[model samples]
Target: MTAAFAATPAFAKDVIVQMKNQGAASAMVFEPSFVQAMPGDTVKFVPTDKSHSAQTIPSMLPAGVAPVIGKMNQEMSIKVDKPGLYGVACKPHTSMGMVALIQVGKGPSANLATARAVKLPPLAAKRMNPMLAKAR
Candidate 1:
């Protein structure tokens, strides 16, 4: 008698994004604002500064994905199992342009346009524009 076995799946990894009060080019920012991740990878938002937190931009979440909100001074990790672009912001610093863009999987994202169209405060928009451009 013989038996057959299934191969194990690839392991998911974690991507660390730091929330800082001061970054190389700006104040109140997420280091490496643009991230490329694989499905099932975890995006961990580490608050290097206690004043910062990470949360999802409602209009920028992929279909079937729930919003992620973190408490100030705490860290948050979001497991991205779907393929698309995810927009994250710091509730208190969003207006000051503290945001991050996580692109999961390869190829184009179906929600790119929708994510770009979401209205943001002037500073947030200014900071996100470049990140969004690279998402395509």
Candidate 2:
């Protein structure tokens, strides 16, 4: 193992998901709503505006995994340790569809059905369906 032939992905990744808010709260969104990473990667949720926080949809997480919930305007980071589809949403603006998805590795998701069955706001549903499709 020489420096010239190093395996870059062997290292952990730190990614940022920005919560963007337009003039009004109803226009809030997550910039770059879809993210992909490998195990050990950490996704950082940053509030780019006001009144927004990142939290995982429990049913969307892999078995034995816990959900992540962040405070408004405060950043949150979650280490990726499994292969599955993870959903994130801004609780306050859920109706505006402030949602995102994280795809970890290339394995088939183990909780897609439960994730889909989880209750979602109308706008969140509109925003998350396509993302769930591509993730699976």
TM-score of every candidate: 0.92, 0.85
Angstrom error of the Cα, residue 111, model 2: value is 1.5
Give one digit per residue, the lDDT tens place, for model 1 in 1-136. Answer: 1232223226779999999999999899999899999888999999888799999998997898999999999999999988999999999999999999999989589899999899999999999999999996
Candidate achieving the largest TM-score: 1
Provide the lowest-lDDT 10-residue window in model 1.
1-10
Q: What is the C-alpha RMSD of each candidate to the true structure, in Å?
A: 3.1, 3.9
lDDT of 2 by residue, 17-92 (tens): 8888863334677867878888779999888788899999887888888999999889988888887878898888
lDDT of every model, 2 decimals: 0.91, 0.83
Q: How close is candidate 2 to the true structure, as a TM-score?
A: 0.85
Candidate 2: where is the Cα deviation over 4 Å? 1-9, 23-26
Residue pairs clashing, model 1: none
TM-score between model 1 and native = 0.92
**Which model scores highest in lDDT?**
1
